[model samples]
Target: MRATIAPQDPADNSDWDVDGSPPDVVIKLSCPNAQPAPPSEEVESFTPAWTQGACDVLSTDLLSAPIQFSVIDVDALFDDPIVSVQYQVTRADIDRGVMEFTGSGALRSVAFQLTTYYAE
Candidate 1:
């Protein structure tokens, strides 16, 4: 999913970078039914991880709720959120083992892998 991003954080409209340069981005992947997975690292335009992909392995139980994805700028003092979106994965998605979704807020572009295994 993709949406345009400005230099400021959409969450609070704060500076995204401290040094007056572009922000290095990170991806936060989570599901409401489970604890958030580790933050995935990425570089400029958040392309490194997004172009390739970030992965989080989870159980089918976690799929009960919509998937959560957020983009954040990695700051030395603190990280700030740029965008967040929630997508409900349906049985069709599980059966296909892949799903296509969209962005809801402030996202420029994003791709993350939610790996799940289930019986047919």
Candidate 2:
């Protein structure tokens, strides 16, 4: 799995200076193989028990800031047990100077860990 970073606005170059100092950044995670398994009996009985896995962040270049993340989209592939997950990170989180990007895994048995970086 790979995480890609891109400016939200293509025409807005003010965020970056001549020295390559980016005022803000956004990080997105695109997992091609992520899916939720069948719920257990306990889950079925309770309030929709969703599988929880660990997404270990291996690395990041983002400065210490309060980063925000949200699930943007999910796509299920054909003839495969894997699904795709898209996560979005906003610039407001960067303004707070937060570092770590932590979240729970999607599937019941599957876990994910990703490394990311903040551009200069």
Query: What overall lDDT, based on C-alpha atoms, would model 2 receive against the true structure?
Result: 0.27
* Deviating ranges (above 4 Å) for candidate 2: 1-42, 49-51, 59-84, 91-120
lDDT tens string, model 2, 1-120?
122222221234332223343222111332222223222221111012223322223123222322223221111231111123343434443344332333233221212233343335
Q: Model 2 reaches what TM-score against the true structure?
A: 0.20
lDDT for 40 (candidate 1): 65
C-alpha-based local distance difference test score of model 1: 0.60
lDDT values of the candidates? 0.60, 0.27
Which candidate number has the best TM-score?
A: 1
Best by lDDT: 1
- Regions of candidate 1 where Cα sits further than 4 Å from its true position: 1-15, 18-20, 32-35, 50-59, 99-101
lDDT of 1 at 79: 66
